[model samples]
Target: MLLDTHMHTHFSGDSNADPAAMARSAIEKNLAGICITDHLDYDYPDEPDLFTIDFPQYEKGIRQLQADFSDSLNINFGIELGLQPHLAKKHHEILQEMDFDFVIGSSHVVHGLDPYYPAYYEGRSEHAAYLEYFESILENIAAFHEFDVYGHIDYVVRYGPEKNKNYSYDKYKDVIDEILRQLIAHGKGIELNMAGFKYGLGHPNPTEEILHRYRELGGEIITIGADGHAPDQIAWDFDKVPQLLKAAGFDYFTVFTKRKPEFLPV
Candidate 1:
């Protein structure tokens, strides 16, 4: 009974998926649960207000779905915060308002600009741009450690101009190792975002090399997510997850309830 631990719905500014539809899709696929980690990237570059959400209303909606699916599917309340070094305090205020089941702290915008946009890679070589992105994760975690896991440690690769064609974990291991160590020290975990495959990267975010290294470094709390924005995408490429984690030396994966972790066999 694996849970698709990250997804989004209409509550997410970038998505218009029906919450009920998402849950139903999970149940139909025989998943034990799915966590709704909708977008909440405060102070996004151009779209200043697009990624924000109404917390109370958002909680109410997820709670309703949780009750509705209690008999068959498990749904958890979660949010994916776009990590920026400066917005830590603002994000902390929101997390205090609710007891979310999970939180994915991800670096969508590095240096006040999103890597999704071409401009972010325009001024520098892709390698330099990517290196700066990994370095910025340390700054973000230094400012805030409330998140349960860091989502898509290598998300920048997905939108890179060459899209992982020349990317390798060893190419950036020094900073990446520190990033993994920092998360372990702070008691935070990393997510295996399967959305990397959906984005045509032919690999998961953080890739196999990073996953293998995280395990070698004794980081145990790894969560799996599709980073899906809709029903059709939930648990995308999840069939590859169990074997992937196993090869990374993991025999278990993780789930969260009321901010507490519950380990389940993989």
Candidate 2:
């Protein structure tokens, strides 16, 4: 059975699908469960505070879906927090008041600039920008202990100016290794995000090389996610997931219920 731990509903500014629609899709796919990890990107200046979902309302929606599909599917309430070193305090304060089943820590900005915007990389080399992104993850590792897993480790590669053709783990092993070491030491796991496949990259977010290195470094806890924002994207390419996990030397994958992880064989 597959459990999709990263998903977004209408509560997220970029998506308009509600919790019920998301749950119905998971049911149709016959997934073991789905976690609604709505976007909580705190530092996006263009987005109003009201654009973010109220925790209470978000939780209530999930509960309603859980009850409505009681016998058919399991739904979890989660958040995908975009953490920046400068906003640690604010992020922590927001997290403290919520009851989330899973939390995914992600870096959407580096050096106070979001790579999604072309201006952020205008003066920087693609390689330097990539390195800066990885370094930011390393720097923030010590301050972030609120999340269960790291989302889209190589997400910057997607928005990079040079495009996917030039980005490869072999070129950034030094920084990637440090990020993995810190995550392992800090007890945080990485998520194998499948969104890259949809982006026409022919590879998952982190790529296979990074996963192999994570296992070689004694990293055990890993989660697989489609990072889905639409119904058809749920459990996207899940059939190939087990093979990737096994190749990485991982015998199991993880799921979260009530904020606790449950392991299942790969």
Candidate 3:
């Protein structure tokens, strides 16, 4: 089975999952490894609570989970960063100070507001909003190069009002191609976040089409993640992963440890 590279726990502002419980859940699913990628979004707008996280406590939690489940499955300490161009230095500093096995740079908010909220879509067409979101990704990549993989390149579609009904990779390839090229040039990778299926999009985030394009463009590193926030959600829809990659022209997927990647057969 593919290792789940993205997940969250109580340490993250948006989840209440216990680290031990999440570890046990992965063992039950027979997953060989999992990276407990808790949220770390510095300067998130409008949410005073902050997803920056209690680093000391969060590190302590994952360490304990690792000790308890050491023999059962590989539990890696990782983080999911909310990308904002201005916070690049802060993100780099934290990663340098920590011993994270992996880091997923993601854009949960764009231009000071989360697309999950209706206010972000208030006066703009969904198409325009989506374009702006992709553009923001370029700005972020330009500022930060410390992360190992880009999480859900098309995350905006998951919350769009139309919800990808009229979306296609070709529709935005003009910019999406550039995004893919930037990651390739930097030797970075993208993750196949299964939460898209849980969200009823009937496809993984970035979808199969983008995956194929990434491979076709000479990009090789790709990671698979459930983006699970709860025990039951761990590795959700994973059975489709192997074939999904096969259809996208990938014979292998990638996993990270100590900030490095190891390819696994699909």
Candidate 4:
């Protein structure tokens, strides 16, 4: 069975697809389940209020889709909250008011700059930017406790101007180790985001080495996601997922219902 835990819908400003249409696409692809993790970014400068979704409306749409497609597929409601160190209290409050099945905490902005913008890396060396990105993730994860999983541990690499040819666990072992230790300490899972492949990059987000290290550090509870924004992308490249997890020493993949994990053998 296929499960895609990360996805976006029209509720997110950058997307034009709605919940039902996303569900229809997933059903057509024969996916067992999918979660609509609409963007809930707050305080982004460029798109300051852009890409944020109304939680009530998002939940309603998800509920509608869940009922409409109950016979064919399972529709899960989730939110991807952008974690800013200073906004932890507010982030927690906002999450408390919602009833989502899953919460993905992500770091999209570094020092108030969205890395997606070209200028974020204009004059800096790739090493500087990468180090800063890793540091920011450490801070973000440490500050937020309202999320079930950390999304795209190495997402900044995709938008980075230079390829991180020298990027490896050995080079950044200390930082990677700290991140994994924190995740394990907090009992949070890290997502295996497959969108890395779609970006023409040779590695999945966090790469294989990082995955192996997570296992070595006694971390379990890894979740897989396509990070799909449209229907055709649902469960994309899923055939390679099982092998990837097994190679990383993960014996099972995780699924969530009512925010609880259900393990399935890899």
Alpha-carbon lDDT of model 4: 0.84
Please say which candidate is ahead in lDDT: 3 or 4: 3
Clashing pairs in 4: none
Tens-place lDDT digits, model 2, residues 6-66: 9888888778787787788888887988888988876576654733677777788888888
Report RMSD (Å) for each prediction in the order shown. 0.8, 1.4, 0.8, 1.2
* lDDT by residue (tens digit), candidate 1, 12-108: 8889999999898888888988999999998889889989998889989999999998898878999999989789888888888778989999999
* TM-score for each model: 0.98, 0.95, 0.98, 0.96
Flag the better candidate by TM-score, 1 or 2. Answer: 1
Tell me the TM-score of model 2.
0.95
Q: Candidate 3's C-alpha lDDT? A: 0.91
Per-residue accuracy of model 3 over 1-266 as CA lDDT, tens digit each: 77998998888888899888898899899999999998887777787466878889888888988898888899999999999998998888898799999999999889898888788788989999999999999999999978999999999998889898988988899899999999999999999899999999999998899999989998999999999999999999999999999998989999998998999998
| lDDT (Cα) of model 1 | 0.91
Better of 2 and 3 by lDDT: 3
* lDDT by candidate, in order shown: 0.91, 0.84, 0.91, 0.84
